[model samples]
Target: MQKNPGAKTIEGDLEEALFHAGAVPEQDRGCPKRFDWARSARTDKGVSAVGQVVSGRFYVDPPGLVQRLNSILPPQIRIFGYKRVTASFNAKKFCDRRRYVYLIPVFALDPSCHRDRESVLASLGSENELVKCLECSERGRKVEGIMGKRNFDSKIGLDVGKLESGISSNNQDAGTTEEKIKDFSLGANNGGFDIEKTEEDEVLVQDVNQEEVKAIKKSDFRYGEEERERFNRVLQYYQGTHNFHNFTTRTKAEDPAARRYIISFDAKTTVNVEGIEFVKCEVIGQSFMLHQIRKMIGLAVAIMRNIAPESLIETAFRQDVDINVPMAPEVGLYLDECFFSSYNQKWKDSHEELSMQTYAEEAEDFKMQYIYSHIASTEHKEGVVALWLHSLNYRNYPDLRFINNNVNNDVESLGIEAKDGEK
Candidate 1:
């Protein structure tokens, strides 16, 4: 249901099919409820969402549901949005996290059209060259600014020492209240004015004191240099909750700017099998501006690639940099997760359920594709092997099938029985 150019046509077809099947009630036959669905920014003609959420009541027979829907739905689209929700539950507000994955194959080619091997090699080299150039251009820039609990500009009015002092005072007040309650309870148990401490009570008191000491000791927290900087920047902006109207994009023409509090920001890196690496930048706030995540990612990518210096992030915050740098593509961005103080457990459970559902759906798709590939290979055995081997060595090595087959008997070594099941 998430936006497709052909959605209106599909909806009409579905309505007609349901009418023919007598699925709708007599009263509702003349008026089917319309639905409003959201589409991704990059959705295109042939592309489709694998896991889109939609909510609506439909009257249909269980036995004929698949048939009726399939008859109306296009081959590229399917009904993957059939979730039930509570009346009070809002999908956007209740969602704690939305994770998206962008997949980029190290090697790819058009399968339908055949090209000369020499041209294919030349194209691959050109792509590599372009990627290298981009990487080099990105690496030369620097970004500057303090992160957590640090002073950005003196004018911003940050007082870290005072904040820490307040936290310490609060801790002392809590401790004093706890001690007074314990003393009061002890006094009540004692007769009139006399106070007596049993050996068991003394031991219990000692254990409790030790535990409190351990807890206090464990509470001593510190941040790494980079982490401290990132945290300070977020806290500086997020501490006093405000409308981030200017920070984010508006969905509706009249919708108010989003109210947000910076929760946290963490940056890390990942290394792939081929020694290629990527920096993973994660920022969490109460709410985000439209495309904010992607923008942040773009900044980070710019910094890591050296296209912008570390100072550039702070400059952007100060509105000093050119705003023309469009946000990074959504494919490489993810909604990592969201945070909620109220109904945290429910939100967590829902996220887990959604994640598991996505995984299962993806697994099923993979399974079907695997089956299809095996079937196709069975019908074209020699061609499949040749294609597979060509893919394996296409990037870095030469095609040495003749050498391998003659010298090491790789065909037999691979457990492929020669014709008549003999090696």
Candidate 2:
């Protein structure tokens, strides 16, 4: 789901690219449309997908096909491999699950002056130095508190009552499961995801709910082993169905549409060139609403920072509960994979179902070089996550307007487009 402001969708551009490149025939695609095209996910600006699948008729054979498509596509977008699927298959309908990986730099998690609070405070033992650190933290928390309630809907203006009413209802299953999710990590090596690692822990019982937790590893993180354990445990809270109204905009707390099922969430530590450990978090789920994943990570980070209570998660899931969820940067997020087992089972004998393995190895390498590097570079401008955490301890906005507030909460209706197509 690649996007460019003031430009057509990546899907539309791809069709044109393929047609002009001699894949979709000009005649077959008439006013009624010659070939069918469908995609599995939708992404907002600054988002990238490495294994997004789309179904359409192609004119070329399997050999040298990837090279041919890449020749016509832009440098930012690449054509991986293609697989022929059964006629009954629809890319959007047959898809079962979507997986995402959020990459974080270990150094970014550290406070501006030092790796952590104790380290920062210890280096500045004098009374004057202690006061300065507190002052900086106080200022940062002001922004973080504001960001917790900030969202596309609030910025655009939406009716708060209807939004909460819609999501808080019993219907929004988001299709997760009714089972409880558990945290079971073994050691600090796998991206700093150290757990009990006992044989009993390894023998995880497979229930309908456990089956959904797909991601079992993590990425680079800057926190210590203690923080890593807390981070992993916090992920389990998001495993089953929950009211995610606070995570997205323009949705009611009771809205059934607000419920989403998270199958798996895990983390590990990765060391950057400077030797700082960055904990990378991976979450796989049935699907997510707007800004849901980022908020989850943001809240998790705040908890690890000891700025917010883990009880906030429990409150967030309750009906009509208002919780501030600081949003994580989108730069580190990646659409790692999508599953279509429901349809794949029927067609596995024919091929490996629909996948992007053909160019996966190369495409991922290119993403790390071009995409991840740029995200890390731009991060220098402002440490969004750190600033947000600072706000957890303190926030002062006398005139701030939030939908969850009890009194004089104005409901303004405005036209906002919903991109339910991509994740």
Candidate 3:
């Protein structure tokens, strides 16, 4: 469903591979075929899935079916094994819940990693470079006097004037030099960034496009303990049922499908990949629309980076406020697993449990070498997250400005504040 030119999708690739393996007859390969293929979840083009389940009618005449499929399928995709299920089984319809994981470099959420470069760019009047990284919709409406530097009421929480002054004073001593500019574009940290890279991971640095590589070398950005904790807090905002019309496309607030229940959304742990530290954020929900996971991650990251206020998220769930939330890159997102506990329980006596636990180790290895490595390598080269952060600052969504200027009223109207004794 996620389009990538000249690439093979799991659905398309599996359909063809089955044909080659003699499981799908040549006649069934055409559009008006007798068999139907269905997957538990739809993944984006670049997104990887280690525990995806697909159901289809297959002819299991001969032995070595799994071996034959593997031999014909590409290396990137492999079938661990299969089990015969009931005739009424439908992968998507019977799935109870879905889990997803997103891998993000430490620097993406650490403001200190980007602060100095942002200051340098501002000083050089080259801030436009950051604004042009992505296409964002202008909200058109503006709050009167919100654009001017003003002291925010302390009762509402964040002090805008003081926050601005603090950042300015801290960076006042930061000097712009030709070398620093060069290093800024290349994301080199001068002993400040704390991440380490392996020798093989370092190879991606060479031959990177000068234009694309022109970013604050973020490797030096230290994603300390405090920063990680704060980011986790930011992620907790999406942990309940909410209208997520803004998080995906072609959906309106009034649409019943826009309402989704999130079981848990949290930053579970950090993993070292090719010397770069990536935080693994896992999300569990009953169902998700297209781009829902990516947009949720994007809004959370934007809030963490201070490009958007925390209240913007609450406002997005309001039916009247339609904010164009950004979608995070698909490279880091993957379908971790799907659950069918209810179905399995009812048929415990007959059918084997439909689960990926048997192949968990192989799945982890595939995700590490193929999925995680590709994410790290691509991020190190393209700096997609870094560029996206810059764009968020310039996007100027009306809801962001509205909430910033009227935090108290916004919170009161939305009723997002916790009831007494709730937290």
Which of the numbered candidates is closest to the native, going by highest lDDT?
A: 3
Model 2 agreement with the true structure over 101-170: per-residue lDDT tens digits: 7776654444342223443455475552421222123323211111112321211211111100000000
Model 3 alpha-carbon drift over 4 Å, by segment? 1-7, 115-224, 395-398, 402-423
How would you encode candidate 1's per-residue C-alpha lDDT over 82-183 as one tens digit per residue?
223334443345444333222111111112112224433455546422111110012121111122122233122211111000000000011111010000
* Winner of 1 and 2 under TM-score: 2
Taking the tens digit of each residue's C-alpha lDDT, what string does model 3 give over 402-423?
4353533544453344333422
Runs in model 1 deviating more than 4 A are 1-50, 64-76, 80-83, 87-90, 102-289, 318-322, 330-423
Better of 2 and 3 by lDDT: 3
How does candidate 3 fare on TM-score?
0.71
Output the lDDT of residue 94, model 3: 81
lDDT of each: 0.31, 0.51, 0.59
**What lDDT is obtained when candidate 3 is compared to the true structure?**
0.59
Candidate 2 whole-model C-alpha lDDT, 0 to 1? 0.51
